[model samples]
Target chain A: MGKTIAEKILQSHLLDDGAVVEPGNIVRAWVDVALLNDVNGPIAFRHFANMGGGPVARPDKVVLVCDHFAPAPNAPGARLIGDMRRFAQEKGIEHFFDVGKGGIEHTLAPEQGLIVAGDLVAGGDSHTGTAGAFGAFGTGMSWAGMAAIMMLDETWFKVPESMRFELRGKKAPFVTGKDVILRVLGEIGVDGALYRSMEFGGPGVAELNIDERMAICNMMVEAGAKTGMVEPDAETEAYAKAHAKRAYTLVRADADAQYASRHDIDLAAMRPMVAKPYSPENVVAVDAAKGVHVDQVYMGNCANGTLTDLRQIASVLAGRKVARGTRAIIVPATQQVYVQAMKEGLIEQFIAAGAAVTTPTCGACFGGHNGALDDGEVAVATVNRNFKGRAGHAGAQVYLANSYVAAAAAVAGEIVDPAVL
Target chain B: MIFEGNIHVVGDHCDTDVMIPGRYLSLVEPCEIAKHIFEEVDPGFVKRVQPGDILVAGKNFGSGSGREHAPFGLKGLGLSCIVAASFSRTFYRMAIDLGLPILTCEAAARAAKVGQRARIDTASGEIRIDRQVFRTQPMPPFIQEIIEQGGLTAWVKAEVARRRASA
Candidate 1:
């Protein structure tokens, strides 16, 4: 049987002497990138110091981004930044980005050339899977797991069995990878695909750009899938050739690659979907569900702040303005994306449209700054999560949607269909 | 590695925000982190928690961002074990590597109720609750070894020291 793309990457990284690794078998594989941010960098630094590990094999291979709660308003936040700066200077990790230079952990890694197709990246943050958009086999780890990998250049993996998502037909203009992933969550339930790997393919996947692919892969963990992968095709080729540090090969499953399960979806039939307040698993179509009032509309994060995602938002908000009661916040995922959005005048349109453009930080998605909702306020966000209290006050609700729907909802100050706009 | 504790929580995809919010992330004091651990997902989480409690969760437990504090907070607060149907990719690896006992017993997570007392035997991968023994999915031998040695740092240090002493 032809192995899936995930298997191909795992195989390339697997050690020959490791215990027999089968589907469900866990083995520590080599990690190509180990990323940490300011919030957690200090802890990892202390842990690494205690370990007394030799100099990191490759300082440049490690990315230290200070996005979480940086530009500290408190003593704790300021101290974290200071701790990270001293550690970065001592270790000489070349990719360190301080407050102004860094944003979210997931976004900064990719933009800085730390993530590439087929690389195995491990981050100290859970959303590290966001890099899977670039075709890298990425996952998050604890500080200790990261420290170990930093020293040993290896970590454990459970070779997840494969599930195939074979999408068919072209999607509606407003329907996006976010909707598709929500649909996957609805079908698979929360743990239906637990500890499994999902491979997206078929005719429909061809239509998705790298951003959409990233969005789909970004939420694979939500479905309890260990990771999500797309067969590197023409889109992958184009992205890898242009953006990646190295040249690329479009890896795909052989005709007979084994799959544990399969999901066939028709994209054109999909409508604007929402992961209702508190959970991405509680998903429903926007029009089919009751509209809820929102205090904020946040568009950015590793999940949906890419160029493609931004373009979708612009299309919806082009000639419109965000409602007065709602604060529309747009965070470009990376410095490069921020630059591109500026050159394309998307930033001006977003600002004139009454949206607040913040630095390319993880920002509001993590409920850190700028757009955190007060108690009882609701937020419609383009980020991956909608878990309860995710955007600050537990009473404050956060609803997840695609960038188009997010933009539309920002304009309406409530959940609404992007198609209407 | 063996963990005996009271069952705690039935959360779904207990994200990092719940385990440790981004705001308090700047704080390095494990005690401060322990105070807010799971504060968001379950309001009374820290107050209600006991030292030897096990967290049983459904689906994608520890989903969203890879904050190591999620596990570190619990460990510092005297968490004994975490048994779930499934855990987020990074959380699971980090938990075991940090010497925190994490077992996966899909059926156990489904069968066990919050506050139930359970005992886990890491070597045998057996979990006993109310005298009913359930088997957890076994960790790889090397992973088991790491846990046995009190997580990655100790394991690595011991191995290197042993090699040097013999040499």
Candidate 2:
């Protein structure tokens, strides 16, 4: 049988001359890139030191992004972040993106052209599935996995059973990749695709832009998926050539590839969705959440904080007033996203609309900074994962939604359909 | 590693972000991070869990984020072992590297209860609780070797040295 895109990528990285592996098979393959962020880098560096402080195997392929709490949230955060920076310099990893240069690792990797199609990328953070939008077999690893990757450029992967999410039809206004993926998550529940790849394709993938594709794949983690991918096309080539410094190869699944499961999503019928506390998969249409009062609104994280998302939110908030009692926090995903938003006047629109703008960080999303919620409060956030207390107080609730809805909720002080506005 | 302890049960999809909330992520110290493990689920969970305690959890234990703090926190809290119906990929791998034994037995999740004295055999894949016994897939011997060598860091150090020496 022909292989899926994930299988093809894994097979290409096989160390042995004849490594015939299939779904559910455990195979050891070389990792093309080792991705690290401030949150995981310090722990990984400490582990590496504990392992006799060995030199990194391939410095060029190692990327360390300081986006979690850049500018340092506290003394310990600063100290740990400092150690991560020193390790990048000491290891001679030129790809270390610090402070201004770094953004959310998932978003930054694609924009900086660090990841490309037909590669095996291992990110130390779970959202590494974001790279899969580029048609790479991206997967999340722990600190020990990072140690193995850095020291030997190798790790074991259980060739996941593949789930094909075939998308068809055009999306309605305010409904983007986030909606499509959220619908999929709702259908599958959190662990629906456990250890499986959600290979996205069909007419719908071509209809969406690179950023939209990114938004969909970014939430694969939220679905408890190991990876999410879209087959490479002209836009994929164009994006790589425009963003990536190096050349990349395009990979395609065989026409007759056998899939373990297939889910068909009709984009036209997908309504703006929200994942109410405290699970990303516990989704309902925005209208179902009407009058669900929100104390705060957050719209920036590796998942939904893209230029496209900003443009959408900016258009929604331009000339609109944020509700008197609600606080809206807008964070662009990257420095580039920040600058572009400024140039486009989205920054002015947000500020004039009563939103607080912050530099790019995983803040507020992970309950780390800017708009951490207080107990008994509720928030509508554009970030992924609404797991209990994820954004701040353990009792504070968060509703995960698309950027458009985030903007509307910011202004409405409740979960309202942006389309209705 | 053969371990015996009182089982403490946690529910399905016990997210890692909740186990050690993101707020405590900046604190890399094991003991400090352990203070927040299960802080969301139960504020006093860490204080109450004794050394050599075994955690029996429902499906998809340690789901969410790749932060090692979740597994590492449990390790530092003196959790000798965890047996869940299944585990999140990163959490399962982190536990192995932390030298914490984990067994995936469907029966264990339903059979285990708080303060239920249980004995687990990593080699035999047998988990004994009260008068009942559940079988799980035994981890590979090489993995046990890695744990015996003191987890991933020590094993990696030795491997790196061996490679350099061979070269």
Predicted model with the maximum DockQ: 2
Global lDDT of model 2 = 0.86
lDDT by residue (tens digit), candidate 1, A1-421: 5777777778778766656556877765786788888766788877776677668756767888887766665787778888878877887877788877866677666666668888877777666667777777776667876776666677778787889889899988788888999999888876667677788888888878888888888888777676767777777777777677654445677788888998899998998888887777888889865468778888887768889988998998989989988888998877778889999999999999999888877667777776787889988888877766768888888888889889999898888887775
Flag regions of model 2 displaced more than 4 Å. Answer: none
Residue B2 shift from truth in candidate 1, angstroms = 3.9
- Supply candidate 2's per-residue lDDT for A208: 82
Give the top-scoring candidate (lDDT): 2
Chain A TM-score of each candidate structure, as shown: 0.95, 0.98
- TM-score on alpha carbons, each prediction: 0.93, 0.98
The runs of at least 3 residues in candidate 1 whose Cα sits more than 4 Å from the true structure, single-residue gaps closed, are: A17-21, B5-12, B40-48, B56-60, B106-117, B162-167
- Model 2 clash pairs? none
Report the C-alpha lDDT of model 2 over A1-421, residue by residue, as the tens digit. Answer: 8998898889989987487778877788998889998888888888877777657989988999998878688887888779878998899989988888767888888888889888799988899998877878888887877977888878888888888888889888889888888888899988888888889988878878888888888888776788879878888889988887676889887888889888888888889999989898899999999889999998988867889999999889878999999999988888888999899999998999989998888877888877788999999988889888788888899998999999999888888999777
Task: Tell me the deviation in Å of residue A152 in model 1.
Answer: 1.4
